[model samples]
Target: MSIRLGNSCVNCQKYEDHFCQLHETTVGTKHTCDSFDMRAAIKDDNNCTTCSRYMSATCPNPKKAAPHMLCNHWAPQEVA
Candidate 1:
């Protein structure tokens, strides 16, 4: 699977306060690398409970989420 820095990095475990713990440096939201791992997305001061892609604070497509950011692949969560 291909990963984009902007969408993927925001939810990565290494990302902290705009810095990457693994890389030991600050990175932009659009930055990417091979060490990306999907963590729960941030809330961005909004409610994701209504979003279709929101899965208990996780996004399945990108395998990530962010409080203030949404990926291009965002979809409405289906109602069962």
Candidate 2:
């Protein structure tokens, strides 16, 4: 297998060496499988980093909310 990235083992949850831990078959980092489960480590879009209340005390929710956790407090981040 060659060192590769993108929608494949490098970004999948079951990636393990030259094979997928879920299917137990030899796979490459450039080839995605039907059972692909994206790794949680991949940065998500709906996050506190992009929220308008990211660093403000007015935000009612936790400061470090889950990557996809959003609430009524969500507002478009203001451009400086």
Candidate 3:
């Protein structure tokens, strides 16, 4: 499988090829079938290097009750 970095993930310099604590290591796939936090999506442009939602452990949008998938905030990296 191929793992694509989303726009958000790519924007953050702190995020590397090694993240995703649920898998206990960087996942190497388009998207993992594991449960991940949704809050990690809200990153502070001036303060945070990346959003905590990358793996916070809870869905911020509980009203939607979205499925447990890779960070929805993740935007597939653009190919030049």
Per-prediction backbone clash count: 8, 0, 7
Distance from true location, Cα of 1 in model 1, Å: 20
lDDT of 3: 0.39
Clash pairs, model 2 backbone: none
* Per-residue lDDT over 4-79 for candidate 3, one digit per residue giving the tens place of the 0 to 100 score: 4454422333334646544555544344442543344433242111334433444354354333343445332223
Q: Estimate each model's TM-score.
A: 0.42, 0.41, 0.25
lDDT of 2 by residue, 25-60 (tens): 888756787888888765446566678776687677
Error of 1 at 44 (Å): 11
Worst 10 residues of 1 by lDDT: 41-50
TM-score of predicted model 2? 0.41
lDDT of 1: 0.61
lDDT of 3 at 51: 32
List runs of model 1 lying over 4 Å from the truth: 1-7, 41-80
On lDDT, the stronger of 1 and 2 is 2
Best of the two (2, 3) by lDDT: 2
lDDT of model 2 at residue 45?
A: 62
Ranking by TM-score: 1, 2, 3
Shift of residue 24 alpha carbon in model 1, Å: 0.3
Candidate 2: regions farther than 4 A off: 1-5, 42-80
Worst 10 residues of 3 by lDDT: 42-51
